[model samples]
Target: MIGRITNQQQLVSAQRNVQTSRALLSQLQEQAATGRAVTKPSDDPSATASIMRVHAQQRATEQYGTNISDGTAWLATVDDALSSSEDILRKVRDLTLRGANEGTMTPATRSAIAGELEGLKSDLLEKANTTYLGRTVFAGSSSAGTAFAATPAPYTFTGAAGATVQRRINDSETVRVDVDGAAAFGTGTGSVFALIDNIVTDLTAGTDLSARIGQLDTHVSALTTQHGVVGTRYSRLQQAAQSNLTQSTALEAQRAGLEDVDPAKAIIDLKSQEVTYQTALGVTARALQPTLLSYLQ
Candidate 1:
C-alpha cells in the first residue's frame, strides 16, 4: 500500500530548501564583497597551494633584486677606483717620458718632476685603498681598516689574501663584487708604489729610465685587465636583474589568477542567488499555510 505524505514532512522539506537557498545567497554575497575567489583554504585547497608557492617565489625574487642592486653599486665603486688609478698612472707615464729626456734635463727640472711623481704615487696609494660602505673593496674578506699600509717604503697589502666577496642574484647565480688588491697592486716590494718610488729614484740618479718606463707600462696593462673583469661582472649583474624582474612579474600574474576574483562575474552570481532565495522564501510561505477545505477531508 502507498503511504500518505505527512504535514510535518512537507514543512520540514520546505524549511530545509529555504535554509539551503539562504546559505548559497550568503556565500555569493561574500565572494562579491571580498573580490577574492578563495578567501580561505577550504574554498580551494589546490589553488591556495599554488598561490602560496607563487608568493614564495615572488619574495625570493624580490630579495634577489635587492642583492643585484647592492652588487651593482659595489662594482661601480670598484670601477671608479680603478678608473682613477688608471688616470693617475697615465699622468705618471707622461712625467716619466718628459723626465727621461736626459738630453735637456737640469737639476731643478729633475727635482720638480720627482716631486710631482711622488705626489702621484701618494694619490695612487690612496685609490688602491678605496672603501665602499665602510669596507675596503680590495681587502678581500679581511676586517682590516685599509687594503694597503700607508707608511713605509715597500707597501704591504693589509687586506685578506684570499677573500672573495660574492652576492647571490638568483637561486643558481652569484657574482663577485670585489677585486684582488694584491693582484691589481703588487704586494711588498713588487707593488706599484715601489715601482713608482723606483722610477723617482732613477730620475734623481740620472740613471737609464727605460727599464722603469717599461715597468710602468706593465702596471698600466694590469690595471686595464682588472677594469675589464669588473665590466664583465657588472654586465652579468644587469642581466640577472632583468631576468628577476621578468620572473617576478610572471609569478604575480599567476598568483592573481589563482586567488583574485572577477568582480563582474561575482556580482552577476550574487544577483542570481538573491533571486533564487527570494523565490524559495515565497514558495515556502505558501506551502506552510493551512487550507480551509482540508478539515472536511
Candidate 2:
C-alpha cells in the first residue's frame, strides 16, 4: 500500500509530535520545581506504595519511642523508692542492734531510739506510696492516690493484687513498668509498716531486739532484689528506644529516596528535554513552510 503521502497528514503528525514533547518538558519543569520525583500516585504508583509503607512504619516506631520513655520513667521512680526504703530499713537494723546490746540500755537512749524508729516508719511509708506523674509507681494500674493507705490501721495495700501496668516497646515486646505494692511491701499484719511498729513495741517492753533486726534484714533483702529486677527492665527499655531511633532514621531515608528528586539529575533532564522540544518545533516549522503555489491546490 505505497499510497501518495498527503501534506495534511504530515502536518497533523508533526503537530502531535510537538505536543508530546511540550508535555514532557512541562513535566520535567514541575519535577525540577517541586523537587519530588513522584508528585502524585499516578506519577509512580509502586514507589508511592512503598513510601506509604515506610511512613506507616515510621509512625509506629515513633510511638514505640514514646512508650519506652514513659516506661523508663516509671522504672526510675520505682528504683529510687526501693533504694530509699532499703536505706531506711538498714538504719532501723542498726538502731535495733544498739537497743539489743546489753551495755547501752539507758532510759534516754531507748526513748531516742523509739522516737527515731517512728520517724523512719513515716519515711518508709512515704517511699512505698511514692508517685510518678501523680500516679503511684508501685500501684500496678490502680487509680488510688497512694499505693498504701496509712489512715486505716495495719496500713493495707491500696493497689490491686495480680494487676499490672505495662508498656509496648516494640512489635514483639511488652514490659511491666509498675511494681506490685503488696509483693514489695506486704499488707495487713504482715506489712513492713506493721513490722516497724511491732519492733517499737518490743523495744519499749525491754525485750531483746535481735529478732526485729532479722526481720528488718528480710525486708531490706526483698527491696534490693526487686530493685535489681527493675534495673534490668529499665535497661531493656533503653535498648528498645535506641533500636527504635535507628529504625526511624532508616525508614525516613528510604522514604526520601523513593520520593525526593536528585537536583543534578533533574537539571540535566530539564535541559535535555528543552533542547529536544526546540528542535521538534524548528523541524515542524520548516516542514510546513507555506508554498508559493498553494492557491492552485
Candidate 3:
C-alpha cells in the first residue's frame, strides 16, 4: 500500500525551500554590492584564510618598505656630510701645497695660510658633528650632544666609540646608515683637527711642511674610502626599496584574487535564486489550495 500524503509536510518543505532561496539571493546581492566573495568566514573558510595570510604579509612588506625609506634618507644625510668634509679637506690640501713652497714665500704669507687652515679645521669639525633630526649621525651610539669638542689644546671626540648605528630594513637585513665621527675624522690629539693645528704651527714658525703634506694626503684618502662605502650602502637600500614595492604589489593581487568577487557572476546567481524563490511560492500555493465544490453538493 502507498503511504498517505500530508499537506502539512508539503507546506513546511516548500516554505523551507523558499526561505533558503531568499537567503541565497540576499547573499549574492551583498557580494555584488561589496565586491567581496567572502563577506564572512562562514561564506568561504578556505578563501578567508588565504586572504588573511596574504593581508598579513602585505602589511609586513609595507612596514619593511617604510624602514627602507627611512634608512635611505639617513644614508643620504650621511653622504652629504661626507662629501662636504671631503671638499673642505681638498681645499686644505691646496693650501698645504702652497705652504709647502715655503722657500719662495714670506713669513706673512705663511701666517695668512695658517689662519685659513685653522678656519677650515673648524669647518671640518662642524661637518663631523652633523645632525639629522637633531641626533648626531657620526657619534656612533653615544648620547653626547655633539661629536667633537674645541677645548683642551687640541679638539677631542666627545662621542663614544666601539659601536655602530644601523637601521633594520627587513626581517633578516640590517644596514648601517650612520658614520663614526672618530673613525672618519680621528680622535683626540690624533684627529684631523690636531693635524691641521700642527700644520698651522709649522707654517707660522716657518718650519718644514713635507711630512704634514703626506698626513693630509692620508686623511683625504680615508674620506674618499668612506664615501665609497656610503655610496654602496645607499645603492643597496634603493634596491631593497624596489624589491619591497614589487612584493607588496604581488601580495595585494594575491589577496584580491582570494577575497574579491566578480559582480557579473553574483548578478547571475542572484537572478537564478530569484526564479527559484518564485517557483517555490507557486508550488506551495498549488499544493495548499483546497477543492471545495463537494461541500455545496
Candidate 4:
C-alpha cells in the first residue's frame, strides 16, 4: 500500500536532523573549551582508568623520592660525626705519644699534658652525643636525646642492641639510615670516654702513656669503619633518588597522554563540526520553505 507524504511529516523530519547536528556541534565546542579529553568518566571510561593508575604510580614515586632525601641527610650527619671524632682521636694519640717520653717531661709538662687530654675528652664527649633534629643519630631507633652520657666515671651508650632506623626508597629496597652507637663508641666501662679518662689520670700520675696508645688505635679504627659504611649508603640513596626522578617524569608524561587533549586538534574538530551544523541548518531551512504546489497537494 502506498501512502501520500505530508508537508507536516517533511517539516518534522528536517527539524530533527537539524537538532542532531546542533548537538554534535555543541559537544565539539565543549571539547575545545576544556583542554581535557576526558573531563567526565563517561567521556572516556577506559582512558580514565588508565590515568588513575598513572596517578597512583606518580604518588608512589614521589614518596620514594622523599625517603631517599631523608636517608641522604641522615648518612651525611653520621659521616660528619665519625670524621670529627676520628680527627680528635688522632690529635689525642699525638699528645699521648709526646707525654710517654719520661726523660723530657718536667712536672709542669706532665700537668699541661693532662689538662690538654682532659679538654680533648670533653670535645670527644660532645661528638659521641651528637644529635640530629633532637634525636641522637648513633642511637638507631632509640628516642634518647643523646647517645652517650659522660656524667659518671665510666660513660654508657644508651642505644639498644640490634635496633636500627630505616627508610624505604622503593618497592624492593630499604636502607638503614642510623649508626650503632655501641659499636662505633663502645658501651659500658670499655667506652672511648673511659679510655680518655684513664689516659688523663695516667698523665697526671707521671705514668707512661705508651700502653694506652693501642686502645686509642682501636677507637680510631672503629670510627673509620663506620664512616666508610655511611658513605656507601649515601651513594646508594643518591642513585635511588635519580631513579625516582626518572620514574616520576615518565609517569607524568603517561598521565598527560591519557587525560589531556591537544588544543590544535580540538579546535580543528570544533570548527569542522560547526560548519557541518551550519550546512544542515541551511538545508533544513530550504526544505521547510512553503510552496504553492504543496498547498494544492
lDDT of each: 0.89, 0.88, 0.85, 0.86
What ranking emerges by TM-score with the best candidate at the front?
2, 3, 1, 4
Query: Which parts of model 3 are misplaced by more than 4 Å?
Result: 152-154, 289-297
Q: Taking the tens digit of each residue's C-alpha lDDT, what string does model 2 give over 25-123?
A: 998999999998888798889998998898889889999999999999999989899989988988988888888884668878888898999999999
Better of 2 and 3 by TM-score: 2
lDDT at 26 for candidate 2? 90
lDDT of 3 by residue, 1-297 (tens): 997656667668878888888888888888888999889999989888888889889888988888888888888999999999999999998998899896787988998898899899889999998988787888877787788888764667877676777877778999998887877888888888889988998888888888888898888888888889999999999999988988988988888888887778888888888888888888888877765742332
lDDT of 1 by residue, 1-297 (tens): 998877678889988999999987887788888888887888789988988898899899999999999999999999999999999999999999999999999999999999999999999999998998888999987888788895663698998767788999999889999999988888888998898888899999998787778898888998999999999999999999899989988988898899888999999989998999999999888877877654443
Candidate 3, residue 22: the lDDT equals 84
Q: Residue 254 of candidate 2: its Cα lDDT? A: 93
Model 4, span 1-297: residue lDDT tens = 999779889888888888888877777777778877777788779998998898888888999998899888888888888889999999999989988988998889988888888898889888888887777899887776788877563677877668898999999999999999888888778988788888888888888788999999998998888888898899899889989988998998888789777999998988888888889888888887888988877
For residue 155, give model 4's deviation from the true position in Å. 2.1
Q: Give residue 129's lDDT in candidate 4 (0 to 100).
A: 81
All-Cα superposition RMSD per candidate? 2.9, 2.3, 2.9, 2.9
Question: Per-prediction TM-score, please?
Answer: 0.88, 0.90, 0.89, 0.87
Residue 173 alpha-carbon offset, candidate 1, angstroms: 1.6
**Which runs in model 4 stand beyond 4 Å of their true positions?**
1-34, 285-297
- Full ranking by lDDT: 1, 2, 4, 3
Model 2 / residue 263 / CA error / Å:
2.0
